[model samples]
Target: MINMQMRNIGIMAHVDAGKTTVSERILFYTGKSRRIGDVDDGTTQMDWMEQEQQRGITIQSAATTCFWHDTHINLIDTPGHVDFTAEVERSLRVLDGAIAVFCAVGGVQPQSETVSRQANKYKVPRIAFINKMDRVGANYQSVLTQIAEKLHLNPLPIQLPIYENDNFAGVIDLITMQYLVFDESTQGATVIKESIPATYLTSAEEARTAMLDSLSTYSEEIINLLLEETPIPEELLISEIRKATVTRQIVPVMMGSALKNKGIQPLLDAITYFLPDPFELGSVAAKKIYKNKSEDIQVIRSESDDFIALIFKIQQDKESGALCYIRVYAGSIKAGTMVLNVGKDKKERIGKLYRMHARTPEQMNELKAGDVGVIQGFKLAQTGDTITNGAPILLESIQFPEPVISIAIEPKTIADMNKLKEVLTILQREDPTFIHKENTETGQLLISGMGELHLDVITTRARDEFKAQFNLGKPQVSYRESVESSSQATETFERPINGKETFAGLTLSVKASERGSGNKVINGLSNNVLPENYQAATIRGIEAALSSGITLGYPCLDVEVTIEDAVYNEDLAHEVAYQSLGAMLTEKIASNASPILLEPIMAVDIEVPNEYVGDVISKLTSRGGIVLGMDMNESIQIIHAQSPLTKMFGYSTELRSQSQGRASFSMKFSHYEKKLS
Candidate 1:
């Protein structure tokens, strides 16, 4: 029955597309919330962070549960800002489907395309909700065209908007030939279905025909009914659409002004009716080791089967400690159950389970297959960990990009020093993208993240949530070191350990790798001369030595190390001997390889009016920018460029000044390039 009754879904869209608003409406209509909370007022339930409320954007992905009909829907609302794409990434990793929200006026924005690609990567089926239709210049057809052209989607509109004097009234369901108008007096809690109006009949018919024509390719029954001119049963049509959508063959489109309370009920109906139930998605694939060899196999859902789950999110909860949000894939788990964290190779007991609604928690006794719940008592739990009760199975984990910028944060007073360090540890545990480091030479703590806003959010949280008062230092660009040319060196270590002569010799080769291909080391020695464990020790030593570059103490990147040769006394062929020799050779390799500095280049997207195009371009170019692409969006010019991160400091201020505060931009780390001489 879990196969037919569960929908693990999320709400995703670009910023200002009304995703949180739609979520608010869902929570209220489903009785999860007593009253609607508006984002403008900073009272939205899904956006629960103070930074999120003040900035009016979601900073963390929030999960909640509600019922739609007989089906249980676990909805996750994810952030839309480019810096927080990591949150979106981890959420999509565990979700079976999503709701793609599009602004009727803004259409398919840049982030829209980005998230579409992310969904496609995870093969998550989605239904498109055309929102903000009540706004002026809200053209449904225009968005449809953009969805097809920009996102390369097969978009099928199942509902046609009913506009009265350019104001959104309701929607005309194409399949049922009925018009739906929400009860304004009830705040859209009740729906009144009526016959299609005479003026909208032609458009509704055209839309239904278009939808059926596209869905026909996936179902022979639909083709037969369409060819015979027979009335297509709504259930049969919905089944076919569900099949095609779950396979990502097509995206069903629904229209609404979520903030104005229009078309939300039908959208919810579509989610349960069209998205795949967990059992329908069937088994999950995991890697198992047999006879020291790994193979991928399916883990089907069954409460009686072996327990398996993935920890896709980790959050620090005041009431429950670390709330590890798990997506159970194969079996049942409950309090007191002992599960092995296969990724960490450690065992942990499930202390308690919770059903989260933003900051609120509802305690549960157990969770079965395909359910999402939070659990505590896991001190070592981390995002992307696979935990199982029966066997060791490894699932593909989420990959996060390296942090591109860093800042030094020092406590304002001696009393807050330990508090700041403790909170930093908590933040690092919760967010895998957040990296903390210490400047050993200067005795200062440095925190690194994807962008400035990311670091700003962390510091703000450090102050507000943890009460760790701190002062921020200048934002620092994260530089890297790489070999500019191929070079080789040799080192011999002769030492006395425990009154025994320990001698080891090794040769290392350094070669330049393609830009963005991070540091790597490989054993080029023959096992006949060296043991596998000793070679492994050498690799570990090389990795450690590369962490601090030869010049300027930056981390190394885009370089390759090779263990060209090695010789050691059989009696003294120990791990330490090889490791010591390896470290010595790495220093020699760095000196001979012509190590050079590499700086991060960010992919920036800027949108501004035509009048300010020249000014914006001039400012970007002055920051060592290179124009990659440009397009015209209505009256705005969208310029895509790459610039060194060092030159992008205070860009937001300068751009607003250049464009009279009417322009906006988003940027993310792109690639590492050689610093200009």
Candidate 2:
């Protein structure tokens, strides 16, 4: 049976695109909260952390549950900033549906494209919302075009913005051919519907016709009705639209200003009507592993199947240890059930289960399939781990990008050393992209992340949340090394340990691959040349060499290594001999391949006033920036450019001073390129 009453959805967008604001409205209108919370006031229910409230940005993903029109919606509000993109990534992996919010003034921003690609990768059906319609220079038509051109999405606009006396008053519902307005007296709780006004009838009819024309492919009856010049039924239009949306053929577009509280109710109605329920998504793919072998399998999305869940997130709780947030895919389990951690290969008992509403939790005796809740008292559960009833099934795990920037950090006082160390451990467990290590040469502690803002957020949390004082050195770019050409090397190892002779011989070749392809190891030797039992040891050694780069001691990328020939002595030579030969030959070949340094390039979008455009461009170009393009929205100028991450460390402050605080920008990792002098 399909569980059509439950929906799993998330709100995702670029920073300052009003994602949290829209979430606040959803909570207030659903009666989960008494009043709407504001981001500027540090009162949003989703951004519960102190750093989030102070910075007015969401630093982590927050999950909650609410009811809309008798439908239970499990909602996740993901972070919009690029630094916390891992939060958005993992959230998208587990979500069946999402709301991709876009700002009306700044259409198709950088991070906006990032989140859209993430949602696309997961095959999550989505509905687009053109938010900030109340802001100046808000162009609904322009944004619609950008969505089609830049995002490569077929945007089906279901509503058209209505302007009365030069103000964003309401919207026209194309499906019902009615004018929908919100009552400010009730904080937009009461929606007022009326016949289309006389002035907007022509435009409304045209839009409704286009909507039906696109949706006609799903239903023959509507195509027949349109051919006969007959009015289409509202039920038929809705049915066809829902079909297209659930299949991800088209993204139903809606317009609203989340801050002004206009057009939110219709968006909520759209969520319930168009978004897919858990049952509609069908079965999930997983791997069944047993006896050192694995096979593909499908886990049915039903409550009667064996218990299975994926822990998508882990949060440390001061009072109750770690909180493992899971989304159940099959069967039902009660509190205190002993579950097997498929990834960890261990068994742990569930101490408590609770349905979370922001920071608060409501205890539950049992959690059923198609539900998202927190499980406590599991010592072995981790992010991306599968928990099952000893089924030996493993689901696909979430992947995060490597950190591209680093900074040296240490506690300000020796008294706070232990506390700071504890904080770092917890943070690393919570976030996969955050990496911390000690420099073997300089003996300095280093922390690396996606960008400078990422490290800033971490240090701020250490001081404010954990009450640990710390200082940071200047930001450093995390460069990578790759070969410029192919090279080959052969090495022979002979050693005597404890009167035992160890001997091994191997030939290795190294070559550069496509940029951003990462490192790969391949075996070209035949079974006669190298036995199957020794391949694992040789490959492991080669991987170890890849991590220890030949040039500058940085990591290696976009490189391929192949083992061509090998000789082993079964009686005298051990695995360590082959491992030593493999590592030695791999490094020698890479060093001979003519290695070069690679740097991270950022795709930057800057919105500045017209007068300061030239100055901004000049400053950016002086820092090795390349101007990609520019767009104009009224008096505001949008500049698109690419610059190295090293030159952008303090660009935000300089831009503010140059533009006199009239310009704002958003940036994200674009790609890695050969470092310029």
Candidate 3:
């Protein structure tokens, strides 16, 4: 039986680094499946989505359970594509540890570095896997060296590959001083426990010594013992390894060719022995609500003593209605129990508990601490909502990156309008990064995401899952406008009727602000000229005017506006008329200040063969890109640059053709920069 103390982990990697193959091998060896699923055939159990099968790439993170050496292991396989980075981000939020995969031939790819940075951001302890050691040009030693030099990680190899290319057979475990050989005909792993392989003894000993030397840094006593040439206790060494892993001081790198089933058992053993459990981290961070004497609520941290759970993901099931996935931090949650949603300030009753298996779910009665499970009929629970058993807890919400690409979408026929609305609403709820907004001025429904693939997946989901037909326009870059310099303007609106005149006047000033500071309105009118309520109405009007820009009808940001003076007639003063007049004055001032268009710029990191670096750089520059820096290691070159989103509409196809399928790039929204004349 597997140990109950075991916690869940996630495996993340860049595209085409054999992450799914590794997952498949683990499932096969653990007896969860009778046969392994191959990514080449699009039959991987974790990537069951139709879009994933069609594209042969994982679009959503997949979760599964298995056993390794009497320890229960819950593994979540995350997407490597930059467009679906939200999947990796959400998975890391709940995972206790991770296996970051890097290809032996490619070493650390661009997306690999991206995911590594994300794991570090979440403080997730990780182990490295150098997969595909049997492929041509595969060099395990070079990849391990790259992990230390390029990614800035202290990677100690626990197992050494015995052969390369077609001769690859097994691996030698440094800790156990044993050799594990794979019998392909029997599809089973055999351990040669009696003696070490003579061919690998020298390299294995060197690797073992290196492992011991690295472990010694975690403890002075171990270093002293090593210096004195005394034998260190195995238990003490294991304890130090566990401690170093939990503290994220070192990452253990292992090599394997999952396709050949070589080195699989050793990798599983390392995971069970080296990875840290959730309880080892003491308590997950959360926030609780405290009621003050004034009947107001305040947020407080709840580490372990409080009952806290955060809703990380939510799905709409066709048969079950809605399923909310939650991660419990401190306490157990039972089915049919009432819990408070501190974020929404509402109460919800859990209908049923389910242990997730990718798209399928297994029914359960309860979920304990440090467990991830799904609850049905949580109407008030959102992606970032907090659930509490005792007092209400208001935890920090998850923040997603902004969308960089956008397209205007409309229903093909009037009959499909209602369906489109329904589909878009559901898609927005499911994907936090997708933004669907109705542009009232332009009469367009704009959908935005990280890139073209991101938006394409949503449209595919709408058609396949929701049965909705829609028309999409060419992708467009989402942009904004702001004032270039400070200026002031005064305007008056007067109406004369029956020889009597009603008048309103206002003076406003516009000033530039720091980038991303957004728009702000300050009211400086005296009470004698305009009442407080009228001043408030004027401020609202100014905000409305600024939102629908004075140029190109885009949103304005990084600017400040102040209403310096105002004149109003008490008899003729009306909220609607005063607000309308203020709106006109704000627009007048904005036009006089000379606004400039600010286009979205993306931070792009590309990894390609050294021979193709020149072509990639030339193509990027042709698209108005500015090269920030270049890094070269071994046979690949990594280029970092900034490019306008408007110039990158079809760059993906160009990049693929330029590198002949030997390159990959990941880009995210960096900032907005003014368009040069």
TM-scores for the candidates: 0.96, 0.96, 0.87
Off by over 4 Å in 3: 1-3, 164-166, 188-194, 290-306, 487-511, 516-550, 557-594, 607-613, 633-636, 659-663
Clashes of each: 0, 0, 0
**Per-residue lDDT tens digits of candidate 1, residues 430-503?**
89999887787888999999998988898888888988888999999999988887888777778877777887
How much is 384 displaced in model 2, in angstroms? 1.4
lDDT of 3 by residue, 1-677 (tens): 43565757889999889898888888888887778888889888888888888898988888877877677788899998989998888888878899988888878877887788888888888889889988777888888877888778788777777763467767777777777677777665554443577867898889889899888888787899999999877677767776788788888888888887876677777777778766767544445455542233433323344557788887777789778888777677778898888867788898999987777888998777777788898766678888887877565667677787889899999898888988888888778888899887676899999999999999989988989999899998878889888888877767654555656677889888888877888878789879877787888888888887886888887889999998788886666656776788777778778789999998888888998988899999999999999877567788999999898888889999999988878887889999784
Q: What TM-score does model 2 achieve against the real structure? A: 0.96
Span of ten consecutive residues with least summed lDDT in model 3: 293-302
Local distance difference test, each candidate: 0.88, 0.89, 0.81
Angstrom error at residue 304, model 1:
2.0
